[model samples]
Target: MTAAATTHQHTNCLRCGRKLTSTKSTATGYGPTCTRKVKAAAKAEIVATYKPHLVAKAEELIEQGGIVALRGRNVFQVVASNGVDTYKAARQGCTCAAGLKGKHVCYHRIAAHILSLAA
Candidate 1:
């Protein structure tokens, strides 16, 4: 077999580390069940962290011509009426005043979510 074909032979799911037998599972490095679990977990996390008011505010900001830029895989830079704000939606969270205070969700994070969904 060719080198590329040999390298593509994955034997286990990357997330669950379970043995893979199906053609699709080997090719993707994740079994169908594992993929569903991962996707569900991600969706649940987003739902858990979501704040309705913040999301609304973010939508308003976008409607007002705010710009959102991807700084990294999970980080985003949002330029709005207030100013430039950075938000890491994956782990670090938003660096805005509300986020830093640990009291409420920030509009920047919601904006980042909107941008991510659009992408």
Candidate 2:
């Protein structure tokens, strides 16, 4: 067989490196089980380390027109709730009362984090 034909003949699962068995697997280049595992791992990695409350707050901030601004290095300011409240968001923590005590992740910090990810 020609070199191009030989190369095209072998199809391997991208995740497990196993020979592709089914037509669907060959088309996707990943076995169904491996694809599921990969998706699960990705979801777990994103959710496991983050605080769910903070993520929810961040989403809320986005929906409410929260504005995030950089005051200085490692310092951010989040104006939320239609410009009613302004909170300082820093790398160490946030300036909000809840963040001051280190009891939980505050919405300001979460909003700043979300803005950073978007940028």
What overall lDDT goes with each candidate model?
0.55, 0.56
Give the alpha carbon lDDT tens digit for every residue of 1-119 in model 2: 23432233327654345798887666555567765663454344434656877666665553333433455324565664445567778646887788889987776766555444333
Q: Which candidate number has the best lDDT?
A: 2
**What tens-digit string does per-residue lDDT give for candidate 1 at 1-119?**
24453356568655445799998777655677765654454354455677666656765554333433455435655554434343444234676667678676677666556545443
Collision count for each candidate, in order: 0, 0
Whole-model lDDT, model 1: 0.55
Pairs that collide in candidate 1 are none
Give the C-alpha miss distance for residue 23 in model 1, angstroms: 48
As for model 2, its CA RMSD to the true structure in angstroms is 16.6
